[model samples]
Target chain A: MLIKKGAEANLYLKEWHGRKVILKHRIPKKYRLKIIDEQIRQYRTLHEPQLMHKAKQAGVPTPTIFMVDTANTTIIMEYIEGKQVKLILNELTKKERISLCKKIGRLIGKLHRNGIIHGDLTTSNMILTPTGKIFFLDFGLGEFSKELEAMGVDLHLMKRALQSTHFKFADECFKAVLNGYMETFGQETEKVLEKIREIERRGRYIAERKEKP
Target chain B: MEYCLGIESTADDFSVGIASFEGEILANIIDAFISETGGIHPREAAQHHSQVAGKVLAEAFKKAKIKPKEIKVVAFSQGPGLGPCLRTGATVARALASYLGVPLVGVNHCVAHIEIGKLITGAKDPVTLYVSGGNTIVSAFDAGRYRVFGETLDIAVGNCLDVFARTAGLRQREGMPFGAIIEKLAEKGSRFVPLPYSVKGMDLSFSGLLTAAIELLKREEYSLEDIAFSLQETVFAMLTEVTERALAHTEKKEVLLTGGVAANKRLQEMLRRIAEEHNARFCVVPKQYALDNGAMIAWTGVLAYKHGQTVPIERSFVKLRWRLDEVDVPWVKE
Candidate 1:
């Protein structure tokens, strides 16, 4: 059965070796040249599964890659049965939400510590399983970037995601997330957080400059 | 019905418009300072605005069949634009408001785009994709304000296209800017040259893509039409992706496209398909209002006037960096 049809890929439910799985196929875009489209789909399909594995190794939960059909640009991964955190984040009690934020923070810290950047770090990319474990999904845009700039952009993206979708508790939730991040990386996280501030400052400066008549 | 006059001198366009409180546009007169060269020169554009200010005002008054004394309020674009250009418009607006003994409203150019878009297309509470030579932002109204969900991290999409056109020796088509010149050629090209597609989460950066496209021209690696095609496809795809994400996040029922760049057929097609995929109504303002014009300012000014959102003369100075989200839209509901 077809599940979700995203801009980059389509999600389908299928059975793989007697186990429920999600078949994520990167759809070929008609607007792109066929060869370039094929290359991009192939590259992303190959990289996403590898990133998922690395993320799992770094103490974050990710779907098990059952199989990868590079020819078709498809990945059959273990079906994760859970609610997207964005859908239920507001429903959670304040304390539970803060705890979830901390979990998110630590997971991000682990990813950053391993020099992996989740390109799309929104709450929608997170799944809350039955056991309350947080699983990061959709590493399609993820890459190995050890640069503090990339790490800062990642945290900044997450912070912005909270501010946009969860503005009510964004400040507190981001604080909790930072608390967890600082706890995991300690002093090392300081520079990355400072990078975020620099990024914000840069944005402010640009906006200010553009504002000048 | 009370009428408001809106003066827009945000960039190269000096326009004056009159509208009723109920959103009826009476006059929308504009005098654009088209640059013969690649890009606009700020001081020259300002001088052009100052020169055409009187004639445009007279034409607007004549078209609207109303004298200056009949206008109840005067609104001018406060900012997110060029400084000298904004100052020229502000000076004209403040003098008119003072002469006519009317209230003044300092309108955010970005918010005015959204507001006029809503007024024209009848899209209530849309996730707005405001793209132009100056801005690339995805916004939605929430919590009594239009919150920016995503924006360009560097140069705007239109600027990227304009610069590419200039480097490629493309000529501006009648009624279309240099970017549209690229779009017209792109329609015939079947090949897509590979260009950088930069999307940082919800935000995007186009300088890399712009540089890559220009470099491709220097390399002589691809046909001009092919490169143009590729650039439009890649850049519009980035915009469409960010807009789709904002739509999903906001779950808004409507999508509105505004700004000068929204006139591109490919962009409209891309955004319309995404809006359809999400089961949201898609709306684009008529081309006249879509591009920078006085009517949007006039209509938005009416909205502000109804809510007592006017600015005092002393504090009505132009704000070059006024953020759309910073404006409290009292007229809009939660």
Candidate 2:
């Protein structure tokens, strides 16, 4: 199997039914007691697919699982032959990046409308294939929650990623993403955005204050 | 005999367990604890999982005196844990399970705790107090399934302990989990300032309780120990009260303590005493199985495997909201 190791899961390129697919295998750690790990794997193996289905309903692109080998803790999904949004973001001329950023933003907005929060929202997790479609991948750390704080963090994650990765034109890219996000989230976006500011303020306050000032 | 290896990495401790089709525990190993840098950084924890996960799995098999080929199933805690930590275990389990040509099972970390409680208690049917670093709840087996009766409205019990410890300038993510440290500090401390007791019907809120404690300590320069003492007292009492109510509502004669909080001896004592007072049986799993771990998954996997329930690789998904009630009981449903 052609395998690429991720920080958490091992990604393998596999062919099933004459079509290529990506297999995300959650490897087991021996450091922990046995019973605990079994429970976690069982829950997650099922959780990821449900998220994908939900995302699909929300108009996001995700690979369909061809097979789930729970005994192996592996999820085999349809593979997209495209560059990651991370790599593509670089290849995009400013206008393209802004355009793609708008699309990403809209996708995130759609996700929010469905009451789903993408736990880790880095550009690298997005894929832009030759078909020019945006496919959001990896829901290993995702959960279903309606909390505004959770939703704010989800947007904040993208903001941080854009700032850190595309500092050259972060403001523009962020604005584009925000516009797209507003397409669906509309008014709720304002609330989460405001909450995001508050969250940042709280974080900064905690960091600065030493001994009660 | 074919076996399924399970791993749990949703939080501070890492757990490994192997189960056979015969319902036997082949091996269960837990790496003590990893210190969090400056605190528990999600990325850092994920990085740690990437580094040692492979070796950890190898060691589990090595200790069990079993070969990877002998294993036919694998499972890991999927959620209700730290995203980074959960990813670490999830990635590892998926990879190894693939290599071994086995079915991968994604078990909810909380549900796994409860299942382990059921196994240890032999209660067959009982009310459950599932408390851990990531969750605090009163649950009961209903209609042949485990269902949530009451839970923390906000902030899990363990999160309260960790957040408080971090605020008090106490070492965060110490050698043991911060919960154990808080318990110990509570034992040594005396001053009990009035802390907020937020018990709304069956639901509880530790976040507010934690805020009150932090606010109190800030208002009156108090030692970390006293704050920890009061926080534990306020939160544990809140939990016990809800559990008692769950027991009464469900009318279950048995109560099992599961999850990381079950590891706390004082909490166990309180639960046992309450159960005894009601003339009900109280069962607590050994400390090893209390926290997020793999054995519970393996044990549950055996039941799933026996029922000839194999999730096709094509239809597999990780459930972020996987509720145990949705799953039919391992044997009875079939």
Candidate 3:
């Protein structure tokens, strides 16, 4: 059954060799030229699993890859039974939300330490299991980048996602996340935070100059 | 009926539009300053606007069949555009307002585009993707404001296309821009040359792609048709992907494509497909409204005036870097 139809891909719940798995098929965009569509789908399909494995190696929890079918531009990964963090964020107690955000921050720090940038670090991409373990999903936009600018952009995206989706608790949640990030990332935390400020300033229409009367 | 007269000289086009207070566009006359050699020279474009300002205003008045005294307000595109062009428009607007003894309204160029799109397409609270030579923004109404979900971090998508077309020695014919020429050639193109596809989260960087495309043209390894095809495919895909991301994030029920590049058929198809995938209504502003024009400014001004938004002569300074989110849109109740 098709569980979700995302922009770049479609997710289906299926049983592969008696194991519950998610069949992620990067759908071909008919509006795009054939060669370009094939190239993108093929590249991202092959790249996402590699990044997932790298994140796992860095002590971040990600779904285990069960199978990779390049020709079909699909990946069969272990199915995670949990609620997306986006759906449960507002329902959680204040203390629980803070702790969860801190853990999310630490996980992101681990990924950055291993030179992995979760390009789309939104709450919807995270799942909290019944066992209370948080698993990160969707590495399609992730990449291996050690540049501080890239790392800062990753965290900035996380901040923007929270502000847009979870605006009520965004400030408190982000503060806790930053605390956890500092605890894990250590020395580079300040620089990365500074870079985030710079990136925010770089955004178009973020007025910094004084308006002349 | 009360009417608003709006002047637009934000870029190469100098236009005047008259709109009734009831949200009806009466007349929109445009005089574009097309450079024969390169991209628009700001000072030259502004001079062209000043020279033709009177004629354009007269033509709009004649078309609308309204005397100058009948206009209740005068409005101009105030910023996020070329300084020279904005100043020329602002000057005309101020003079007209003072002469008619009516209130003056200054409009944000980007916000006008979105408001006009919504007015024409009947898209209520849609996620708008505004792309042009000057801007590439994906925004949606959130918490009483239009918040930008994604935008270009470097050169705009349209500028990237124009620069590449110029580098490839593409000729721009009457009514056909460099982007149109590229789109025409891309139809015959079969091969795809890989280029840098840079999308950092919701933000896009197109300067690298532009540089890479120019380099490919110089290399002569690929056919012009092939390069055009590759460029369009890559750039449009990136735009579509970001629009999709914003849609997923906001979960708005409608998707609106506006700005100059909104006229591209391929972009419309791509955005329509994404909207369908998300089960949202897709709307593209008509070609006349898609590009910068006085009609959008006039319509937005009408909205502002209705909400008692006006600027005094001293405070009517042009804002060259006005952001859409910074402007308060009182007419839109989300």
Candidate 4:
């Protein structure tokens, strides 16, 4: 059965070797030319699994890839049975939410340290297991980059997602996340944080230039 | 019936539009400043606007067959545009409102584009992809405002195309823009030259792609037709991807394409296909309404006026960098 429909792909729940697995199929977009669509889907399909494994090696918990069908642009991975962090964030107590956000931050720090940028870092792309472990999901937009700009953009996306989705406690959550990130990522965290501020200033500069009247 | 007069001088076009309080557009007159040599110079465009302001306003009144006294509200494009151009339009609007003793409504240019599209296409609620030479934004109504989901990080998509076309020795005709010309060339293109494709989450960057396409043209390794084709495919695909992402996020029932770039058939086709895939209705504003015009401002002004949103003459200053999301669209309900 199709569990979810995304912009670039669709997710299906199926039994693989008597174990439940998610078959992520990067469906061809009819809007794009056939050549372009195929190239993008094939590239992303091959790229995501490699990044997922690298992230796993970096000590971040992620779903194990069971099989890869590049011909069909599909990947069968371990199906995670847990609530999305987005859905459970508001329900958690203050202490629990802070701790959870810190864990998320540490995971992201590890990923960045390993030169893996989670392009989309929203809470919806994270899952909290019943045993109190957080697993990052959806590496479709991820990339391997050591550039400070890329890392900054990844964190900025996380900040924006939190502001839009969890507006009430965004400030507190982000602060805790940064604190945990600094602990794991070490001295480089300062530079990455500065780059985030620069990115933000750049965005505002486009809008605030008119204030010079 | 009450009427509103709108003045548009946000860019090269200095247009005047008269619309009824009931959403009927009576007359829309536009006088554009076309630079033969290069891109628009802000000061020159503003001078042209000031010189033609009287003639366009007079023509608008004649076409509408309504006297200036009939207008109950005066509105103008209070920007996200050229500073000098916005000042020219705002001055005219202020003078008219004060002379007629009518309320002045300042409309956001980006919001005007979306509102006009919705008004004409009859889209109740939509995720809008508004692309123009000056802007490329994907936005939707949420939490009392139109939230920008994605936009160009560097240069706009239309500006990128225009720059590439000019570099390829393409001339801008009276009716056909550089984009249309590029589209025509792309249809006959057979080869695909890979260019830089940058998409950071929801945002996009086209400067690298533009730079790469121009460099390829200089090298003469690929035919112009092929380069044009590749550029369109890559850029339009990127745009379609971001729009689709916004659609997936918002899950709106309709997708509305507006702004100057909405006239491109390739863009419309791509957007239509994506909307169909998502089971959402796709609507494109007609050519007359798609391009920057005074009608959009007038119609948006009416919407604002009815909701008791008006600006005082003293504080009717133009905003050259006004963001779409910064404006409060009280007229739209969830």
Candidate 5:
């Protein structure tokens, strides 16, 4: 077992007779009330992964579950050995980047069509397995929402991440992503996107004003 | 078993991860745009993600050593982030999953980071400080969600660092994003121009600090580095205060510092001091996990999987305005 220690949980790389799996165990604290801590741990242990599963059923990409151990606050399942999408993008050509982004946009549009909001959307949470596949992970914060405000924030976060990381070709890259999104969302999603932009602009303006005084 | 593979493109770079039960990181590919000689150009970022997202995912599966038949789920970042970038990641995850006879799960990137931290550190109830370009806040695991106890009413700490990094003429793409160069300059130039320090109970404000720094720069009132130094200090201090408060409020003993800005040694040190003072331990994922990577997503995927949670293919879609509070918690484990 390969144990990875976190602040609140203990993760173990559990392997069984030629089988490989990872186990995350949320350890208890000696300082807190057992009831409260257990409640939090229990809720998270069940709530998060279920959200991931629900997102999967909704057509968003996530991982499959195998076992849940609330007593030890551990989750055990398959372990994929691959690279992150961030690294994969680094290796792609410019033209390839555009084509791929458009496809991504359409996928996001589909998510909105299904009313699934991925609360925290950033590139860091994505994966690019070697065989031309994309996966979404971490639905601990996933939720169901018909409200555009939530969706607006979701898209806004993506734009912000792009601008921050792809400082050079952010605009073009975003355009392609938008292309993909529009493909599935239809033109009606434009208004929602526009509103998101306004919110983002407001945020940028606030930050911009602070930079100078 | 239903599997949900996660693809994150909500930013310049593209990333993908497969989350089974505990999450086996299949791919963590990243593509950065080297500006000829400028700072973050939004238009450019969008184009880049648009271009490379597909190849990245292809590579992700390859790295995982898995075939499409071996997978059962596809997860993509929905939103609560940049639209274009989010769309790029979301759209790709959506399309491929649709073709694979797999279910799609839309993930929140912010929560992904935190969940990864949780997966890596196992911090079940630790306070989370999500310091990033678009967000700056002190968060806590509460009521089945990571609640925002304190956040910037204006700009985010990472964004603040990025703007100064640009103005300071630091290397935009390659270096430590912006915090490193800016913070280093901040070290020598010690003339402190009192920046805005707003901490109204749990809420904080970073715009005021950025504004002060901008004014000083425009006025040429002091050396740029000095102003940068002050800003970093003031902003980091603001974050430390709020984090400390969250710890206190939640009575949580540990602090998990995730996000791009978490890479800053100075910020880490300052936060460590606060944690030490409070007798709370602090956990900051290594740079790979800290800045942004599929490992975090894959790691968080493990937790999500165990709950018997799965998103339907046709119903699955991207959310431009996803919020942490909106996700429903259903635990089959307990």
Candidate 6:
């Protein structure tokens, strides 16, 4: 069954090796130069599964990759049966939302600790199973970056996501994420968290320049 | 019906507009200062505005056929623009309001673009991709104001293209801008010279792409046409990705493109495709309203007046650094 036709990729639900799996195929953009399109598709298709496996190994709950076809630019990954956290966040009790944010915070701390940055960090990119386990999705934009700037940007994206979607609960949700982050990666977590504030301040400064009267 | 007079002097363009309370544009007279060279010079543009303000305002009133005393309110582009140009406009607006005994309103230039796009295109509560020479922001109406979800970190998209066109020695044709010349040249390009694509999370940075394109031109390793194609492809792709992300995040049913850069056909097509994929209605403001114009300011001023929003002469100072989110939009209810 066709799930979605995104800008760069098409997602489908299918059966692989007698087991249910999700297939992500990088769609070819007709407007792009042919050779360059193929190169980008091939590179991302191969790199995404690797990032997924790396994140899972670093204690982040992510769908397991079953098979990959670089020639076709597709990946058949474990089918995660659950609801998108984005849809369920508002229905959850305040306590549950906080608890869930803490778990997500731990997952992110692990990813950052392993030098992985999820380029797009939104609740919509996560799935929560009936068993209450969270699985991260869509590593197409993910990369390995240990730089403080990358890490800071990652957290900033998450904060923005929360603020935009769950404005009423953004503050509490972000604080829960921070609490969980500090508990897991207490050693260097302060520096990275501080970097988030610095990034935010810089963004505000750019938005309102002092020179402009 | 009450009428509002709006003055816009935010950049190289100085325009005076008159609009009825019902969103009908009566007159929009604009005079743009085209720099003989490349980019806009602030002082020169301001000087040009101060020199032509009277002519433009008089022309607007003549076209609208409305006496200055009959106007109910006066509006001006307040901030998020060149300081000197904005001050010139504010001065004219305050004087007009005081002379005509009308209320004075201060408008946010960015919000005016969105509002005018909405007024002209009938896109209610749209996810807006406001791309201009000085601004690049993807925003949606959330809470009571248009909240920015993604933006350019360094330079706006138009500036990037304009600078690249200048470096490539591309001149403006009869009436088209340098960027338009590059767009026409890109249509004949088949090769894509590789350029750096910098999308930091939801925000995009075009400085790297601009620098790389300039270097490619200096290297002469590829055709300038090919480089222009690559620049547009890379930059537009980045913009499309961010706009799509905002649409998906906001779940808005409509996509609206506004501002000067919205005139690019390639950009409009890319955004239309993305909107179609997401099952959203895609609409671009008409070409006349797409570029910087006084009609947008006039229409938005009418809306602001209906909401009982006005700036007192004492507090009507120009704010060059106003963020779109900083404005209180009582006209929109969450």
Q: Which structure among the candidates has the greatest DockQ?
A: 4
> By TM-score, is 2 or 4 better?
4
Which digits, one per residue and each the tens of the lDDT, describe model 3 over residues B126-192?
9999999889999998776688778887678888999998888776755888878889898899888
How would you encode candidate 3's per-residue C-alpha lDDT over A135-163 as one tens digit per residue?
99988888999999989989988887787
Candidate whose TM-score is highest: 4
Native-to-model Cα distance after best TM-score fit, residue B176 in candidate 4, in Å: 1.6
For residues A107-197, write the lDDT of model 4, one tens digit per residue.
Answer: 8999998999988898889999999889998888889999999999899888767766676788889988898888789898989998887
Error of 3 at A167 (Å): 4.4
Tens-place lDDT per residue, model 1, A1-213, is: 899877678899998789999999988765445666687789889999999999999898999998998999999999988999999998999999999999899999999889889888988899999999999999988899999999988888898788778888889999989998887766789899878877765552144344322
What is the per-residue lDDT of model 5 for residues B1-334, given as tens digits with 9 covering 90 to 100? 3344666666555676665553445556666655634445666777887787777767877877777777766667666666677766766766786787666666666777877777667666678898877777676665456665666656777877777666656675575456667767877876766665555435566666776777888898699877887787677766776676567546678889988788877788878876776688889976666665655555555455555555675665656556554554443111
Candidate 3 Cα errors over 4 Å, as ranges = A15-20, A90-100, A130-132, A167-176, A197-204, A208-213, B171-174
Q: Candidate 1: misplaced stretches above 4 Å?
A: A29-37, A201-213, B170-174
Query: lDDT by residue for model 1 over B1-334, one digit each (tens)?
Result: 6899999999989999999987899999988899755688999999999999999999999999987888999999998788999999999999999999999998889889998899889999999999989889999998878888888877888889999998887666447788778888899878877787788888888988999999999999788888898898889988987898788777888999999899998899988988887899999988789888888888899888889998999988787777787788999988
Query: How would the docking of model 3 be graded?
Result: acceptable
Model 3: per-residue Cα lDDT at residue B207: 88
Estimate, for each residue in B174-266, the C-alpha lDDT of model 4 and write its tens digit.
788887888999999989888877877788889889999999999999999999999999999999999999899888989999887888889
Q: In candidate 5, what are the lDDT values of residues A1-213, reduced to their tens digit?
A: 655444345657777457787677766643322444466567668876776676667666666777887777778755656665555554678898887667666667877778777654545557655665556754444567778866776776566555433535667878888888888888778787776755544553233322332
Clashes per candidate (backbone, < 3 Å): 5, 93, 0, 0, 189, 0
DockQ of each: 0.37, 0.01, 0.42, 0.52, 0.03, 0.34
Q: After superposition, how far is residue B277 of candidate 6 from its true place, in Å?
A: 3.7
Off by over 4 Å in 2: A1-213, B36-39, B172-175, B332-334
Candidate 4 backbone overlaps, count: 0
Clashes in candidate 2: how many? 93
